[model samples]
Target: MDPWLTLAVVAGMVLAGTLLLNAIGARVKAEPLIAIVRAGLQLAALVVILKLVFTSMWLVLGWLFVMIVVAIVTSTKRIGWSREVLAAAGTAISVSAIVTVGVIVVTGITGRDPQHLLAIGGILIGNVMSITSVTAKRLREHLQESRDEIEGMLALGATPRQAAARFRGLSVSHALIPTIDSTSTTGLVTLPGAFVGALFAGSDPMDAGLFQLVVLGSILFGGAIAGTVLTQLLGAPKVLPQPPREAEEETAES
Candidate 1:
């Protein structure tokens, strides 16, 4: 396919989707086109950065660090920023990513390729970031919604953790459902990006399948760890969780 033709096709598809959404009265119209444009720009930049990153081990590590920092900041923004929330989000994401990646490295699965390491690490970190944010947000919302029940439990001599245990479990489970469902239905329902990319890069079909399995397992492991750690850290607050605007104002006041 010609490069210009490819670009035209993508633009047309995005425009069609945007118009369809508008016709149906959906809230998303311009965003699809905007997102496709943004993705194209980002991919172009990433191709240049990746060439340099693939050449140097230090660059690989640095890129991974940048990704982790971005993940932490993004998660914090989603869940509300307090000193405590920042610390918890950072810890959950970092710990889960490190442990998951470390196991893969030590087992010699990714071999001595820095590019591979960065790719796997980035995927795990991104997934963990999403899971941690969802878990924290869900836990906070549940806690706030059940404030009276929690307070009653507290008054009945239940510890904070005890009072919030049910919500914590619920939050972790809710946060993990998408990962669980996707993993369960991988080939039939969805072709994961990692798998498709591996095949596109000329990897053997078996190798690509194995790689996808590893990627999926890493995501599940990291997500579980992240959700559990984050909920444990944020679940039993002294006061109930506030909405994002209120939390932002409170943070500003403090």
Candidate 2:
């Protein structure tokens, strides 16, 4: 990527940051100029690092492992359940990996190249990691926030499972929105990375389009299962874990 182009991308990302904060009615505080410089430096560092890492099989595997670890950490950090997060992440990833590899196995009958296999696996794993993280975090937060309503249902003789079921629905659906929108608006509203990247790599339009479609459908299918698993894990912190005390305090203060 060109330096100037990278600057433009950073600018666009900062705009996205502004929009994200503003969407929740948060004020758009001016981000520090050094933040952009630091981001540019980090991008340069990652590019240099990845260049060295991807050249060797051992290093490539190491890089993928690091990415998975980061994804696991990312999922856990966004939510409060410390003990269960790792377990939830590992389980979600395991289920997702099996499903993804299975899909690739079917694709293998058509004889995929090593490159295609790596690319497809990377895409599937990354999306599933995201889905898992988002699902678990949302479920935990919703359940905690809605604790009173949930317990009220429990008081009315609902089981813990029954009490938390509504939140389970809300959180999972909310978590799946991005995947759904990406599927529905693909090609029409936006060109996803799989298609655009394939074309950029000199694949034919039809071939690139097919690859994108297949990957998108596979993600939605596998993500549905992966997301559900993470949500269920979140639901089971103390065999239906209660919300963090901080969350309750924040809600009360508000």
Candidate 3:
């Protein structure tokens, strides 16, 4: 496709989506517009950077680090920038991405091409970031809502970990729902981007399907690990502090 034509198409799509969102009274405000513009700028920058760094392993690693930092910063906006939260998200995403990508490389499923590595790594990291953010946000919200129940459990001699276990489980499960639903409906409801992109690049149907399967599996694994780790980290007593009885009573009186 011509570059100008592609740009026009993307711009049109963004505009249409923004209008539709406004029509529906969505609370996102100007985020869609901002995100679309930001994504275009970021992708343009990435294209230039990737062209320069795709030939060197060290450069590729540096680029991946940049991507991880971006992911962490973006995630911290949704899930607070607390030390434990950052540590949990960073550890979960890094470990799962490394393990998943390592398995793909070791098994010869994907080539050692730096471009391929960066593409796959970025996808894995992005998915994990979303999962971790969702888990953290949901866990905090649940903990806040279920404060009474948690305090009751605590009063009954249950540890903080034990008290928060149910909420943690729920949060992790909620975080993984999108991945689970996508996996369950892959062929019927959705033709994933990886599969479609592979086919567009002239890959065989079987090869494209295999690649998509790998991508899907990696996302599921990474998301699960990230969500679980985040929930566990957030479940700590220090992280999810209980309100004092006096304060609770005072607030109730107010």
Candidate 4:
């Protein structure tokens, strides 16, 4: 692809994304412009970096590592930096990324093609980063929110993990909905860009469908693993703070 064309595409994406952000905010009465703008800047910067990375194999691998580092740091911060939070997010990203890329290369599914390594890495890393971020954030927030109920469960003799059962499971499942919906309504409710682009590139409908199916299925499994595993790790009974018994009972009396 021409460099100018790539630049144009990035510009178009920023324009469209900005408009969409505003529309969503207006509809929901939620102001997330700063959040959306920050995300746009990060994605735009990533596109520019990818252009550089694709020029050489050394840079390509370096860029991949950079993506992992950025994702880990961001996930850690977003989940409210604690030793356990960092450990869980880091573990999930590393495991999920290795699983996704290793399967593709080891099985000769994608053939470890250097020619398309950058493109493939971009897709995999992007999805894994999103999964890690969402899962980490959701787990932490849910854990904090359900701290009282969880302690009550523990007081009732439930194990720590058992105390977190409902909130942990619900939050993790909720985190997977976007991925699940995208996978479910791929062709009908929404034609994914990957499938559309494949057809535009002159691929047969069957070929495009196959590729999309593979990518979507892989994302679901990888995302489910990333979300569920990290949720369990961070939501494990030990992360729950033990409130003083008098404090707890005062609230009960009220």
Candidate 5:
């Protein structure tokens, strides 16, 4: 693709998206454009850094570590930072990345080279970060919205975890559904990035297909582990009572 053409098309697409969002009263006028610009800048920097990173195993490991830390921080911020949220998000993302990549490496599903490791590890870490953030945030929202029901369940002899089980399951399902749908529709509805990239790089069709399969599997595996582990770490919500003023107002009305 010509560089000028690429820039023109991207600019046009961004403008179109911005206009559509504005027309829909999305309330985010400039955020989408800003995010795109930021992403472009980040990718530009990554391209430069990856040149040196791909040459050294130690550098690749260090890069993965940095990715993990950024993932943790991003997830923690998204889910509302606190001691417990930080601990849960950090542990979930780190463990999921390690386990997912370790399995792929041990099974020889992907090459053990630094480039391969970075590619697969980066994908898992990124997906796990998103999964952890969505799962944790959704569970928190569910618990908050269903506070009365959860409290009633607690009063009825249900354990806190048991009371919140429905929300936890829903949150996990919500987090995993997009990945599951994407995997299910692969090749039929969409050509995944990994597969397309591999093909573009002149890999064999079979090799590209296999790599896409591995990537899809890794995404699901990492996401599931992150969601489940974060749920366990989160345990139960502490359902605090209504404030004194609200309680008295309700009492007076009753």
Candidate 6:
């Protein structure tokens, strides 16, 4: 396939999809077009930069740090930009990513190659970002919805953590559902991109399957860790501030 021709075909397909979506009242507002343009530009730049950076371990680590920062910014938008939120999400993502990637490197499952590091680390960080965002958002929503019950428990002399435990559990569980489902349905319901890409590169089927399993397992583990951390950080004190003493007295009187 001619590269230029393939590019033109892809651009045409994107335009047609955008037009059809607009005609159907989808109201996406040119996002798809913008995404296509951005993807092309970013990939082009990355190709040039990565070739040089891949020769040095420090350069590769720097690139991974940049990716984590980007993930943090993206997650901060979905979650709030509060200090606690940033700390929780960043710590969760960084820790989970390091642990998972470290295990892979240590076990010799994936070598110390910069290309492999970037690919696997990118996926892990992205997954952790998503899980953190979802956990934060859902935990906040749950706390809001269960305000009365939570307050009642607080009024009965329960600590904020105790009061919000149930809702926290619910939020973390909801956030983990996607990862769990993907892992459960790996070969049956979905052919993951990693597996397919490996096969396309002429890897043995068993090798591809094993590699895919490792990726899936890392994602699931990282997501669970991120979700749990986010939920734990979003206790009642973070979401529901304590009322003034006067207000508490008035409520008690009522």
TM-score top scorer: 5
Clashes of each: 0, 0, 0, 0, 0, 0
Instruction: Give the lDDT of residue 29 in candidate 4.
Output: 34
lDDT of 1 by residue, 1-254 (tens): 69899999999999999999999999895999999999899889989999889999899989888899999999999988889999999999999988999999899876559868987998899889999989998898898778889989999999999999999999999999999999999999999999999999999999899889999999999998898888889888887766667778999999
Q: Which one is best on lDDT? A: 1
lDDT of 5 by residue, 159-179 (tens): 988888888889999989888
| Residue 177 shift from truth in candidate 4, angstroms | 0.3
Candidate 5 stretches greater than 4 Å from native: 240-254
Q: Candidates' TM-scores?
A: 0.88, 0.75, 0.88, 0.72, 0.91, 0.86
Task: Please report, in order, the local distance difference test score of every candidate based on alpha carbons.
Answer: 0.90, 0.73, 0.82, 0.73, 0.88, 0.84
Find the number of clashing residue pairs for candidate 4.
0
Which 10 residues in a row give candidate 2 its minimum summed lDDT? 109-118
Between prediction 5 and prediction 6, the one with superior TM-score is 5
lDDT for 87 in candidate 2 is 82
RMSD of every prediction: 3.4, 4.3, 3.4, 5.8, 4.0, 5.6
Error of 6 at 226 (Å): 0.8
* Least well predicted 10-residue stretch by lDDT in candidate 6: 238-247
Off by over 4 Å in 3: 239-254
Model 2 lDDT tens row, 35-89? 7767678768977986686566566556556666776776667654467678887
| Clashing pairs in model 1, backbone N/Cα/C closer than 3 A | none
Query: Distance from true position, residue 16, model 4, in Å?
Result: 9.9
Better candidate number, 3 or 5, judged by lDDT:
5
Q: Candidate 6's C-alpha lDDT?
A: 0.84
Ranking by TM-score: 5, 1, 3, 6, 2, 4
